[model samples]
Every structure is written in structure tokens, then in C-alpha cells.
Target: MDWSSKTVMVTGATAGIGAATALRFAEAGATLIITGRRKQRLETMADVLTSAGANEVYIHRFDIQKKEQIAAVVKNITADTLSVDVLVNNAGLSRNFSPMWEDNTDGWDDMIDTNIKGLLHMTRALLPGMIDKNSGHIINIGSIAGHEVYQNGAVYCATKHAVKAITASLRLDLFKTNIRVTSIDPGLVETEFSEVRFYGDKERAETVYKGFQPLTAADIAESVFWSASMPEHVTIAEMLVLPTDQASATMVYKK
Candidate 1:
């Protein structure tokens, strides 16, 4: 896969898996379009991407949860004549770790709006360009929760399951075309994920990975890169990545 001429768009590239994935492509000398809600963080990351050997780095600050914002960003990118060769849907999070009955609608709303609707909005906005060019790849960042549900995470799990369905259906929808759709579902990757889910409670987040070696953002980034770089004829439709200490979404070995 020759990345030198490719332009990859990654959502939520300010940190965590999104940042790592963008950096991975940057190392391959790819042009990167990084979008996130944090303007300062995105600006800071542009320099890092440039230093990492990205041919070019463009930062757009927008919250994916907003459909209008996603539309505007896509319009701007198109105006700049930047056609994204690959779109990595990674702007998603779990709001709270609580049972459905105990949780409020606020967390549920956040999870649904960002995880499912945001993904759909971005994909819908950019997919036409791919269809027109007849060349592109859509890699969705999913979770083990997509395949198996866990206790107290019903809503979050549902969002991921929606992602799984979207990926599969998109693949089928574009079967006749050259475009590829894939989902990279990972188990435990220690990032701001737990912290964010716990509402910035660092102590609670720390305990989630204390007893086992969890996957890193870069680990998942590598897998994402591999899946996207495959030959045009071959599509790595789905990849389920888990650490040695983890099996299912609930089965994690603690030492």
C-alpha cells in the first residue's frame, strides 16, 4: 500500500486511538486530515503529525455529534479539493458504567448521538465522494461490546452493536463498487476511554487495568493500518482484537 499519495481522515484525533491511528499513517508519509472537538489539541497534534513524516496535516475542529458541523467540515474538505481516501470513524465513547435503569438519559443521549448518529452523519457526508471516485476505505472503530454485552453497559453496548451492523450493511451496499468497509473491534485498550467513561474519575479508571496487561492505542492503530493497507482485491472485513489477558468483553484475567 502506497500511503504517500493517500489522504486519511480520522475523527477524534486529539487523543487516544484516534491520535495513534493518525500517527501510524503519518509514519507512512500519508497526508492526514484530523478532526476533533478540541482546537488547541488538534493544532498541537498537527505539528506532531508533521514531525512524524506526514506529507501534510490538516486539522478541523468540530464535534462529530453535531450533524451540521460534520456537513460543514465535509464541505470545507471538498472545497479544498481534499478527497479522503480513507475515513476512520473513531469519535465515540461510553458515558457511564451503570445499569440502564439506574442511568439517566443524559449519558444515553451522548452515547447514541456520538456513537451511532455521528458515525452515520460523517459516513453519509463522505461516502458519495468515495462512490464517485470508486476508490476508498471505511474503517470503523468498534468494540468487543458489539459482539457480546456486559453488565451495566447496555446502552454503550447497543451503540457498538449498531456500529457492527452498519459496517456489515455498508459493505453489502457497496459490494459492487471498489470501496471497502471494515470494523476494527478491540477488547481492552488503555486510553482516556475508561477515564472518560468514569467521568474523569482517574482512580476508578485506573482500577480497570490494574490487574492485567491491556492493549494500547498503538496496538489497535497497527491493526487498523494493516486492515486498510491490504490489496484492493482483499478486504479485511472485520477484526476482533483482544489482549492476552482478555477473552470476551467480560472475561479478563487479573493477575
Candidate 2:
């Protein structure tokens, strides 16, 4: 599992788990291609990665929602290298907490566009190289909601569930190619995830983390690194991680 010479592409690399994961891989001496919509943030991350001993740090300013942009990025990636050793799909969105009957069309579309369509485009765009190379890893950062429904989370949960299912299908589809696929399903991760989901309602976000220590971005980053570093013959098909006090989506215990 020597990552020194390998290359990894991570979406949503500007902050949180994606940023931490990029830092970890860079610290291991891997080359990096990090992408996010924020130009400044992406540039800052590239600098940070270069400072942390990465041999090559590349940044792409593009929106995951744009299929054309994804295709263009993939073309550019192919021009640089025939293949990318690892791909981490971390860019995604969640909707506001509203009942299924509520008129939240925009929020639903956002969730589907990023979580579902974005992931598909990224995978389809780069996976061909991996198949040709016969060696690569794909990590999808999913959530506990992927497996269980939560109040006012129908669309978000559905999108994550799509992720979970796709990871399964990709694993099977790439069996002959030896390209590993894994889904890291995290539970109760304390990050901008909650704040964004609540649309900046600090109290609502805070309540999601009450009475227990939630997993941090770094924790999930470590988990992803571990999954990718495993022997070529091994694949951690899926990983469901939760804080000790939390059991499941609806089973979180509060004091």
C-alpha cells in the first residue's frame, strides 16, 4: 500500500472530509487532483497539499452538476495520465427538512443532481481508464441515511441509497478488471453537513449532535485511507461507521 507514487482525484475537496482526506493522502506522498466549485478554496487546498509533501498537486475549478464539465475534466485527466489510481466521490448535497408532501422541488432536484447524477458522471467519465489499467479504487462517501429513512429526509435518503446501490453494482461490474469499489457509510458526522441541511439554522444543526460525540471529518478520512490502502485483492465493499452512543438513523440516544 505504498501511496507515494499513486494519484488520487477527490471531488468536493475544498473543505471538511474531502479536504482532510486529501491532506492525508498528500502526507503519504501521493499526487493529488482535487476539485471543487470554489476557485479560491481549491487553490488554497492545492497550496496546502504541495506544502505537505505531495509531488504534484492539481486543482480543477468545476461544478459537479455540469455533465459537460465532468466530461471535459475527464478528457484533461486522460491527457495527463492514462489512469487515476484512486477516485473519491465526496461532493454531494442535502435538502431542507420538509415532509414528503411539501413543495420542495428545488431542494429535491439539488439532492438528486449532486448526490446521484454527479456521482454517476464522475464514475462513468474516469472508470474507463481504470478498467483499461486493471487497477484502481473508487470510494463513495455515503451516509447512514442511505440505509434508513429519517424524518423529512426522503430525497436525501433516496440519493444516498442510490450511492449505496451503485457502489454494489460497480463492484460487480468491475470484478474482472480488479478495480475495487467501496462505499463508506458514515453516521452522525459533525460537519457542515448538518448546517447546510438545516439551511444555516445553527440550533437545528446543534441538536443533530446532542448527547454524543459524532464522528469528525478526520475520522472518515482515516477510514477512507484505510479502505484504499488495503491489498489489491481485498475490497471493503461497505463500511458503516457510527459514534458509540448512536445505533442507527432513528436510534440515536440522547441524555
Candidate 3:
């Protein structure tokens, strides 16, 4: 199951699950194509992976919010020198929960654009190459929120739900092709995800993982590896991951 020369691309590669996943693939000897909008952070991550064991590492720094930029990135990556073996659409955004009718427009736009539209743009950009080769894997980082919505999470939930639906749709449409599509839906992960969603409110972000165990970035990273490493004939479709003490989105028990 060694990746040897296979090239894998991961967005949101600067940190969290994407960073961890990139490290895993790099260790397994994959040629890595890592991307994120953050410049220095992404460069530092590539340094770590290069030190680990990656054969060749390429970096693309671009904001997912810019659709044209995403297109340019795809062209650059797919140039004569590079071809993708796997594409992980890990870039996403979440927002604080607020009353739907009481002026939630700002959060709404960010969540919709980053979470939903951004993912779609990346997929469209990269899938043609995968289809041409008749082989590739796509691992999307979805959330339990996609399955069950909580208060103050209207737009976030909507975007994730859209993820769930799109993952299914893409799988169906690509049935004839050997491209693998998977959704790694994690319950609650103690990552920068919460801080961003809570708008840098450290306390509120910390509260999400209080008094209980939550999944970590490495946990989901291993899941992504498993999904990608499966036999060409097997696709792990959708996965729901939670800590042992958790049951569902709203049913986590914390002390």
C-alpha cells in the first residue's frame, strides 16, 4: 500500500486534518502537491513533509474564495510535469450560530461560498484529469453538522448538508469511472475549526471540546489514508467518526 510515486493533492494543507494527512502521505513516499491560502504556514508544512520522506513537494498558495485563482491553480498543477493520483477537498469554513431571520447575511455568504461553492470549484478543476486516467480518489472533509443541525448553525448546516448531497451525487455520476469519492464526516474535532467558527473567541471554541474527548486532526487524517488506500474496486463512500463518549451531534456527554 505504499504510494511511491503517486501524487496526492490536499487543500487546506497548512494545518489541521489536511496538514496531518499530507504528513501521512509524505511518509508513505508520495509525491505531494499541497495547497492553502496561507503562505508562511504552508511553506513551513512543506518543510516538515520534505523532511519526513516526500519524494517531491509542490506548493500552490491561493484563496479558495477566488474561483479564477482556483482555476489557475488547477492549470498550474496539471501542467506537463504533474498529474494527480488523489484530490482531497479539505478547504472549508464554518460560522457561529445565529437566528436565521435576524441579519445573518455576513456569516451566510462566507459559509456558502467557502464551504459549498469552493469545494465545487476545486472538484470541477481537478476531476477531468482523474477521469482521463480512469483512476483517482477524492476525500471531502465534511462534518457531523451536515447530518444534524444545532442552534446558531443554520448556514453552516446548510452548507454541510449540501456537501453530503453533492458527495452522493458525484459518486452516482462517476459510477462508470474508477474515480473514488468519499466523505469523512467527523463529529467534533479539537482543531482551529472551532476558533474560526467562533470568530476567534477562544473561550467559546474551547467550550466545544470541554469535559470530554473529541477527535483530533490526526484521527481524521488516518481515516483519509484508509479511504484512499483501499483497493481500486472498493470505495468507503461515507464515514461518520466520533469520540467514544459521543453518540450523535447533540448527544455528546461532557463532565
Task: List model 1 lDDT by residue over 117-146, tens digit each.
Answer: 999999999999999999999999999999
> Which runs in model 1 stand beyond 4 Å of their true positions?
none
Q: Which ten residues in a row have the lowest lDDT in candidate 3?
A: 95-104
Per-residue lDDT of candidate 3, residues 52-91 (tens digit): 9998899999988789999999888868478899888898
Query: What are the per-residue Cα lDDT tens digits for candidate 2 across 154-202?
Result: 8999999999999998887886778999999999888788888877888
Q: How much lDDT does each candidate structure score? A: 0.95, 0.90, 0.89
What C-alpha root-mean-square deviation, in Å, does candidate 3 show against the real structure? Answer: 1.2
Shift in Å, residue 102, candidate 2:
2.1
TM-score winner among the candidates? 1
TM-score (C-alpha, index-matched) for candidate 1: 0.99
Q: Which candidate has the highest lDDT of all?
A: 1
- Model 3 score (lDDT): 0.89
Ranking the candidates on lDDT from highest down gives 1, 2, 3
Model 1, position 190, has a per-residue lDDT of: 93
Q: Which pairs clash in the backbone of model 1? A: none
TM-score of each: 0.99, 0.96, 0.97
